[model samples]
Target chain A: MTSEIIIQAIVTGLMMGLIYALIAAGLSLIFGLMEIVNFAHGEHLMLSMFSSFWLWSLFGLDPLFSIPITILLLAFCGIITHYFLIRYILKAKMLIQICATFGLSIFIRSIAQLLWTPDFRNVDKPLLEGRIEIGSVFIGQPQLYASLVCLVAFFGLYWFVTKTETGLALQATAQDRHAAEILGIPSNKMFAIGWAIGLGCVGVAGGMMANYFFIFTDVGINFALFAFVAVALGGFGSIIGCLYAGIIIGLVESLGGLLIDPSFKLLYVFAIYLLVVIYKPQGLFGRY
Target chain B: MDSRLEFAKSEPIWNTNNRVFSIIAGLIILLFALPLFGMNSFYLHLFIMIFMHAVMAQSWNVIAGFSGQISLGHGAFFGIGAYATSFFYMEYGITPWISIFFGMFVSAIFAVLIGIPMLRLSGHYFAIATLLIGISFQVVFQRWDLVGAASGLWVTMTPEDSWFALQFHSSKVPYYYVFLVFFLITFFLVWLLSRSKLGYRLRAVRDDPQAALSLCINVSNYKIIAYVISAMIMAPMGSLFAQYILIIDPDRVFNIEISIIVLLITVLGGIGNVWGPIIGASILVPISEYSRIYLGGTGGAVDLIFYGLILMIICIFRPNGLISFIPKDILERKKQR
Candidate 1:
């Protein structure tokens, strides 16, 4: 491959990594706190894409402008979903959590098919339509904005998680929910909040994706797998880990796929996953 | 509390009164008599599909229902068996029946490669990893030069040689009998698993890995074993499917739709029950098939929606499954009374 192609691949990978990071950030928080795998998390993202699509169609709203609404709406949805099904598995086995989440995926996908049907929907006007020319290397306009938004979101989340009171409480609860409860941290409610935030990120991602691509029911499964692999690679519950892992995955997907076919990229990722589990296990940034 | 505990601990006492058994027996008898009644080829074809799906569901139940490891990529092994046999038949001129062992072996190898690290993930990641494995394989099969990529490979062997070829042109009877044997074998395996030490170990690990580990259960090894063995069972079914359909495609075999269908079956009949998948497939497939036939081209998402609603209801109220309702009181008696 040419140096230009390599550079472009890295740039594009980094940007895509950011998008994965945004989704993975909230996902990590929920897993860290509640240990409930949001099987419908990707569906939430899928729905958010639909929301953004319709919002743009009806009201001419920019995806950037619709972010807050999507986040809030998804937050509410997450809380409700948790209350209804996930919380029951909060104290249950990992298998229960799996079945429940699998069911959740089913429910959400079905509902999505019902309301929107299976037709692929997208926004026509590109959020990042133009591009930047850097000598022979060119960057898509959307790619630049997506990376920027991702970086900003990550930094903001890191700051808020470490610096703020509730953030600390969230962390403490994740570490030891019973102790947090004994210390009067309101673990249950905080977990509900974490779920909301986790879902909010999925929604945000959905909207962001809508700007660059189309929406469908099955769309969530691919991203959800990315998030799961990212969370696992980054270690179970660490925010910083998810961010880094997402970026690593994004780059590898680009560079590795370029070397081989894109079809073989997952084989590489799964290999990485196995290596990480056997070696680091705690993840590169996993909490001790 | 004892009764509630019993309910939680024991299988629901089989209620002989439930017409579910009679209905099942009646259906089987009807099917058995259908060939004797001079049935047309269309009905025979439908029966073959039901049997194949039932066999699929039963294979899935071993891993998902019993082991509590929700592997969404059961289709991977199924595909492997299909492709392996097809490749062997075309290239080496091996009998598909003999080649099935090779298919199952290769598929099991892939399962092990997947099962080791992935089995550690347990719930969401386990399912996601399995799904990714299927996706990866789908991508591999679609693009790999050897398998003919997305267009897929077709067996060059004609089905006309003899009865020994395991290929038939005029009748669905062979297909139906093959799937019937598949169903019985899978059912027996799951039944045996339910009563065996392996089953106990799997359930223990599933219930609490740390505790299971504390009890000296090698959690990862046991889970990996369950997953790989389950894959071995699926391979032949895949081989059979490819032979019957005479087509092998990545999307057709390794699709997410297969994952959902298996999940829906286990969920509907109630997870962890022996007959759950059989019951679920029987109930859901006809509705799904009819909807597809009736809806024809336009809007066939109704089946998905139906499953979604059923899953939600199942998950929320009857978390144990549909089987729990009929068997609850009996189990309660075993535990509490």
Candidate 2:
């Protein structure tokens, strides 16, 4: 491959990675705090994407304009899901927790199929519709804006978790719920907050993705699998790790597709994941 | 006094075993007699599905339930079985009866390959790795032209019924009996395994791998054994299903939904128990089938919605599973008395 082509692939991979990071950040946070791997994390992203798609299709509202609404709506969804489903199973066995989330994923996907007719929907006439050329490389405007927004959101999340008192409490809760409770942190509330923030990141990804990607009930699953990989690769529960890991996955996917066959791209991604898991089970950036 | 106490303990165990054996024997005889009464083909088909899934779930139970290794990618083994059997039949015109064994062998080998490295990871990591492996198989199979790629492969069925071919013409009866026998054998094998030393080792590893390791138990070896056994058991179902359906597709057999459904059925019934998969399959298959027939095409996923709700509820209320519920309650009542 030419240097220019390689550079383009890298750029594209980086952009895709940002979106993956955004999606995985929530999953990482939730796992860190609750030790529950929400198998339905991708379904929530699917829900958000549909929300964005519906808003666009129904009211002629641009997905760019629907970002805030989608985040708020998904945050509400996260809260409700936690309150109704997750809360009861908080102290359940690992198998039970996995099943509950998995069932919820199936439930959400099936419901979406029922309600939305399983037809693939995409936002027509998105605001960012063109590509921008820089020297020898060209980039889609949607991709650029999506990555920029993701970068902002990721950094914003980092600021919230590390700098603020609420963030410190959230971390403390994740570190030791009992100790945090003793120290005046409402661990339950922190869990709720974690859910909201985690889902809120997926919401952001969904809204941005709604501009370029096809929307369907099962669409989130395709991306969600990658998010899981990113979370695992970055070492679970580290936001910065997810960001870098997502980028690495995206780059690998794009470059692997370019270098090898596109169909074999996932093979390369999985290869990296297995190597990391075998050698570094804690992930590239995980403290554990 | 010690001998008398041992005899007292052994007596109840023997009695309970005899009672369970008799009940199982009675049920088997009833199952064998059902077709003679001229049951409808639809119910027979449902029974076949229940049996097939029960076998598959039991296979899952060997690893996830007994060995405490949660594999989210068992569909890969199922797919391997289906594909291997169908390929042999299609390319070489091998009968599915013999080809099913080939499928089982292939799946067992695949399980070993996967289990060796993956068994090292604990908890959710193993689950995720298996899930990825399942998806990767799907992707590869979908793209590989040798296996019919995305469109899928169809087995040609002769008009003449051939027992050797494992094909029956115009009747679900033979298929039902074949599946019933297979289900019984699988269940019996699992029961025997559970009662054996290996089963105890598996249970010990599951309960506490550290303790098991300290006691000199080869935890990895036992886990791999469970995984291989589970995969081998699951493969034949896929082969039978392919022959029964007369078609095999990567997406159909290799789908993650299949894996999830197997897990749900096993867990829903009572993981690790011989009866768990049977009970779970009996409840789930009929409900899903009925929902599909009644509530399908209504632009709403009523069946899946209900299915999801039931799964959530079951996980919450009876996490040990539906099969364990009545017995536990009965035992409690007896204790109170």
Candidate 3:
């Protein structure tokens, strides 16, 4: 492949990687707060995309303009999910916990299919329509904006987790729930906030992605799988690690596709995940 | 022991009671007699599917339930069995009776290769690894041209009803009986395993790996054995399903939905017991079959929505599963000494 093509692939990979990082951040935030991995996280992304699509299609609101709305909407979804489902299974067995969220995922997907009819819907003629050309390389405006927005949101999440008192309390609860409780950090409230912020991150990524990607009931599965890899690769509970792992995965995906069969791109990504997980079960930056 | 303590034991005591045994024997006889009463093909097909899924779920229980390794990639093994059997029979003109063994053997080998490396990871990590591995198998099979690529392979129909060929186009009755027998054998073997020393060691590994290690149990080795046995049981069901359908496809056989449904059935009935899958399949299969038949089209997803709700509710409220609802008298005939 030409050097120009290689540079182009790198740019595209970086963009996709930003989005993957944002999604995995949400997952990692939740996992860090409690050891539960939200299997419904992909469905949460799907819901955000659908929410964005509806805003654009029905109200003529552009996806870019609806980013905040999607964030708030998904945050509300996170709260509802926490109160309605997560709270009940908080102390359940690992298998039960996994199944509960998995069931919720199936339920959400089924409901989406029933309502949306399973046809692929696109926000046609969105505000971000054209591509930007820089010398010999080209980047789609949607992808570039989506990635930039994801990067900004990811940074914001990092700031919130590190700088804010609420974020510190959330982290404190994650470190040791009983200890945090003894120190006056309401574990339950922190958990609820964690879910909200976690899903809000998904909201930004999903809203931006709806402009470029197809909106469908099943679109979240592959992205969710990738996010899982990113989380595992980065080490669970580490936000910055998600960013690094996401970029690496994106680079591997695009480069693998460029060098080998495109159909086997996921194979290489999964292979890397298996190798990393087998060798370093604690991940790149995991504490445990 | 107090009555509460007696009931607290995870293992049901009804197995040793001749009364419960007679009841179970009577139920089996009734099930066998149903086909003779001229049941329609649709219902016969439904029953066969339930039995097939029961066998699959029971096998899954061996690994996930007793051993506590939740593998979400069981479709890989199921697909391997189907693909291997179909490929051998279709290409070499080998009878499915023989090819079925080949499928089981291949599945066992793949299980060992996968389980040895992946099984060491615990909790969500293992589950995700297996899930990705399963998806990878689907991707490979879809691209591989030797197995007809994405379009899939068709098992040729026999000219007549032939036990040797494992085809019975004339009647669904034979297939039903065949599946029923397979289900019985799988159930009996799992039951026997539950009582064996290996089963105790496997349970120890599941309950606490560290404790198992402290007791000198080869935890990983026991897990691998359970996983391989589960794969062996799951493989033949795939072959039987292929021969019955006379068609095999990567999407149908290797779909994650197959693995999920297997898990749902096992969890719904009971996770850790031999009877769990049988009970789960009996309830879940009928609901799914009836919904697909009646609702039709995308409306069939209605049952799946209900399935999701039921799974969630069960996990939250009755994680012990519906087996816990079995009458106390039927469950325990004698208190522990």
Tens-digit per-residue lDDT, B1-337, candidate 2: 2343344344443344445567767999999999999999999999999999999999999999999888888899889888887888889988888889999998888888877877876778878888888899999999999989998898778778878667887899999999999999998889768756688789888888999999798998899999999999999999998888878888899998789889889988998777789889999999988887887768776777776777888888888898776666432212221
* Each model's DockQ score: 0.45, 0.67, 0.69
lDDT of 1 at A7: 93
Best by TM-score: 3
User: Between prediction 1 and prediction 3, which has the larger DockQ?
Assistant: 3
Interface RMSD of each: 2.6, 1.6, 1.3
In model 3, the clashing pairs are: none
Docking class of 1: acceptable
TM-score of 2: 0.95
Model 3 residue B227 CA deviation (Å) reads: 1.5
The digit string of per-residue lDDT tens for model 3 on B30-87 reads 8889899999999999999999999999989999999998888899989988887889
What's the lDDT for candidate 3? 0.89
lDDT of model 1 at residue A205? 71
lDDT of 3 by residue, A1-288 (tens): 799999998998999999999999999999999988888889999999999999998899999999999999999999999999889999988888988998999899988888788888899999898999998999999999999989999999999999999888898999999999999998989999999999999999999999989999999988889999999999988888999999999999998888788999889999889888879988898877
lDDT of 1 by residue, B1-337 (tens): 2343344345543533345557756866776667777778776766677776776777777777667788877778888888988888878888888888998899889888877777775455577678778778888888877887898887785747344456777777777777776777677677667656677778777667798898888988988888877888788888888888878888898876777787777777767777777778777888778787886566546677677767766666666667676766442223233
- Measured as a fraction from 0 to 1, the native contacts recovered by model 2 come to 0.67
Model 3, stretches more than 4 Å misplaced? Answer: B1-15, B327-329
Q: Report the lDDT of model 2 for residue B154.
A: 83
Task: Estimate TM-scores for all models.
Answer: 0.89, 0.95, 0.96
